[model samples]
Target: MSLSLLTPLGHSNVAELIARRTLTAVFQPIVNFDGGTILGYEGLIRGPAGSALEAPGALFAQAAREGLSVALEHAAARTCVAAFASLGCEGKLFLNFSAEALVALGETRDRTVAWLNEHGLGVDRVVLELTEQCQIADVARFVTAVGALRESGIQFALDDYGTANASMNLWVRLQPDVVKIDRFFIDDIANDPLKFEAVRAMQHFAGASGARLVAEGIENAADLIVVRDMGIALGQGFFIGRPDARASREFAQGAREALDAGHIAVFPGATRTPVAASPSGGMAAAKMIVAAPAVPKSATNNDVLELFNRLPNLHAVAVVEHERPLALINRRSFMDRYALPYHRELFGKRPCMLFANASPVIIEKSMTVEQMAKLLASDDQRYLADGFVITDEERYVGLGTGESLVRAVTEVRIEAARYANPLTFLPGNIPISSHIARLVEHRAEFYACYVDLNHFKPFNDRYGYWQGDEVLKFAAAVLADVCDPTRDFLGHVGGDDFLVLFQSDDWLERAMRALRAVDTGALRFYADEDRAAGGIHGEDRRGNPAFFSFVTMAIGCVRVSPDTRGGLPYGSEEIASVAALAKHRAKQEASGFFVIDLDEGAAQLHLHEAPGAAMPQRASALS
Candidate 1:
């Protein structure tokens, strides 16, 4: 077992060494971050017994220097396949390859697949990981080779994506099924905003390109928390399991043992173990359960009014008969429909206004406090019930409360806030988009305004981000004040950009006035010296120096008309575009307000026309 004995003496000596079995392979498991399930293992090649080379990296490096890189790769593949056969683990096996070896051998992939098939390992179980340091010469050839292997069920993953140049472009073009982000990027993503932003951008890109992102080289629990919060679905790192042939079996066994013991095992170098709950706690131990509220389908409006009078804070009443659910009637709907004059005749009849879809959004009895919280965080207030009705196969079981759901959602919000931007305190783009879509469906005559701060970058560069941030907060407060929850909405769409939805046209004028007043008042933050010496202070993107002055915002407003008009007055996609155009026009004209005219055949027309002009005016104004 001396190191000198394993040295390759010559071609003949190496051939004899291969014949006599000189190398071995080690397997490491890659685990998912969310549930700690084993995704697969990377098969790391090692030196043979009695070899000068101590590890695979050294052995492969030496092999390449000796012009035997192709031979070494073939030997590694064979050794890895042989070792994989004995494990009987049903997961992918990742094998490494140098780009040079792939191009040089020219026909290595086909032969390797055939050899693997000859052994017990099939192409479906194999994953070829393109090594980080390899320089791909012929991308087309490499793609062709990998594509051929993939047709046989082999998968390709681009390793160390963030570490190399043009990696993103390569990934986009090759369209690999998986892209393993370099550990450097994942290590500090939780604390570093730039790193987190980069991960988010990469994740979005991967999703768009139909590729899965795998964060590799995670080393601790802290890192695991960051990746999971970032919503990464697949992960691989030393914190999960080290590279070893028995790692998967060890993980499976440990997981099963943990399940049986009703406890999870936490240790360094150990596979992930699930924390199982004891079955002894039954219905009596449940925190909250959905109970079918006693609602009569044949009850009159007076009956519902009596029920509400009895329970003034009623969230919703489920209309159910026997064990089956019929509909959900909320307090608001009852008031809106039955409180009208001449609506008394419909009182004794069944309420056709029930939301039957509410059943799908119901909470189950077995749901934990944590799970219940997430459902309520994004849920609408109108859907809240005094408690969720617990049911088993149409049989009414128990009840859950709005208070409990609120507590759960609060916890989820807190957990979500850990990763949310502190300045905006919004759920970022992913959750923000969902909120916008929900607002759109409300179908009100709401004005969605895209707010952009003019010359704010110059201010940031001249004064500092601290003051610039104050200005941003001031703008946010102004917008928030103008937005009425009962009639409007406000959202911070990242730096210096805000969105406000106004249900009332009067509020639009108020919002503009409030923003102007805030901007004017915020000017006092700067010193008297700098205030008087206002001029361009920073360079624009084109490298030209630009002047800095008082802050101003160009607001673009698009009215999302009610869908009841049969068809949209304007295309939804053109709303933001037209608003942006109007805002740009305002910016160019140095005007405080501008409106995007959505009227048909109004091209080249001014938004505000003179009295008695071609455009029609209000009949009251004419009088």
Candidate 2:
């Protein structure tokens, strides 16, 4: 009934409304795509019931006409702060600030500060959103004012960016902590290349500015997916949420989970790949540690015993102290003691800490499965009996079983070795194909660099197979040295051919670095006279001596974007065909350099070499 008074045409005096503080607040959640968590809520203002100025836009416009813009804005701010306090939000609050109000505050934000303090909200909890809708005449003064707020522990975000204030100049001058990409840029972004490019550029710009990017007005699941693929951390809009007065924390369906998983291969007619969680001995511990919330150390022995009995399938329950795992209580061990005479009467009421294994195997989520296994190797009995605790930054996140770790690490390591090249030991055909398929399923970005050693066979004919093997090993080491084990994949496609799957943002850098390292390392393999002469005499296919420059490396780089696929969406044969074409173009260069195929339409045609590469050396390293 009260909401009925907030009609767009409800007549009210703007000045009188400001004086009476007749306004209300609504909240919209700002979700974190990477973490699958509610990052914060953005508080929007509404006018009082039954006022012509009830609509927030109308209210602000009326106040500006009445020369009370600053007063009305402050009134709205106070109302939102009070409203947020009543609900007890768990995250930060993003509030929209008009240019007029900020200019009027000058260098003093006493009003906003006092309201924040009065509401028990920290300066860190407040983020003032400066939208481009309010043009700034003196950009410098605005920057200084925003800087002052930042110095006081308040954060600033450039709202409605990529529209009127899309200028690089504005971004440089304001240097906000976040850029909320205007909704138009995000609308239908999944199908629009221009919008995708714009957001992609902004992503790089955000990285350079040390600011995060938020995609606002994500109205659909498909658009939200594209926004996430472009690597925006914070997301908003009707799809993620709508403005609501009740401060509800719910978000749009499938958006949060899909974003956090960082992959969506919902291509029609595509079968789901085997997505295994070899979390142990892998990346963060949170990946593998199943969430069985820990029991406090102070929990009575009876509590632990009852938990064990209640959950018949339970293997163990960790005794945690302030989020840290202090001990473990195994079902079998506890039952054995409970079966003894008066065991319950003797220790049922005592703290579980006393009966718990004070030194139960504890493992952090950050530790690689390799690291956990190495640590577990110290105690064979414990490895078989008690599992490990997975902690994030020293706080328990979940539990890790030794059996799970062993199974995951052993399978991955053995599979890797089985398919590895006999000499280089880099992954071979099976692992390489599986890796690409898996990454395709997850919709990850990777650069597939197919490297072919030019003149390698000829060099072997002249220098013997053993010498050729030496050069191959040398090249492999150089490639391995450039790979970031944590984020990238390196494989040997047998002989003088190698494949690198780059998953990091700096993939181009790492790829270029590898190519450069190989070029330099190849030179060392040649004898002094050959290195200086820049050519070696080798027998060609015609059995005639040919002048071959020191072994050169040629790389064909294929960009596998999240939304990338050509004629054959999930076909391994198509990948090889495209790779062969890229390598053919790469080998055309006079000197060894890598070239990238940017066209998504024709994978077989129009492979373009990446710019900024060094001058091509004139030698058929493959000849």
Candidate 2: where are CA atoms >4 Å away? Answer: 1-12, 260-623
lDDT of 1 by residue, 180-288 (tens): 8888887755444445556767899988988888888776554555566456788776666677746565444432222223111111101101101111111221555
Q: List model 2 lDDT by residue over 1-623, tens digit each.
A: 01111223224487566546667899999998766788898888888777677787788788767666656666666677788988888798887776655655546666557657878998898887776766787877887777777777888788888777556777787777878899988888765544665677788889999988889888877677667655688898888788888877777666765565444322110111111112122353456686775799668989988788788877788888788888888778888988999999999999888767888777676565445546645645674677767777778777777677767666655544445566776666666676677677666666677788888887898789998999998888888788755446677777788877776678777767877787777787778888778878877889887888767788887776655544235444345445655676788877555456434414333233345444332222111
RMSD of every candidate to native, in Å, equals 26.6, 18.1
lDDT of each: 0.59, 0.70
The segments of candidate 1 whose C-alpha lies over 4 angstroms from its true place after superposition are 1-19, 48-52, 103-111, 250-623
- Give the range of the ten consecutive residues with the poorest summed lDDT in model 2: 268-277
C-alpha lDDT of candidate 1 relative to the true structure: 0.59
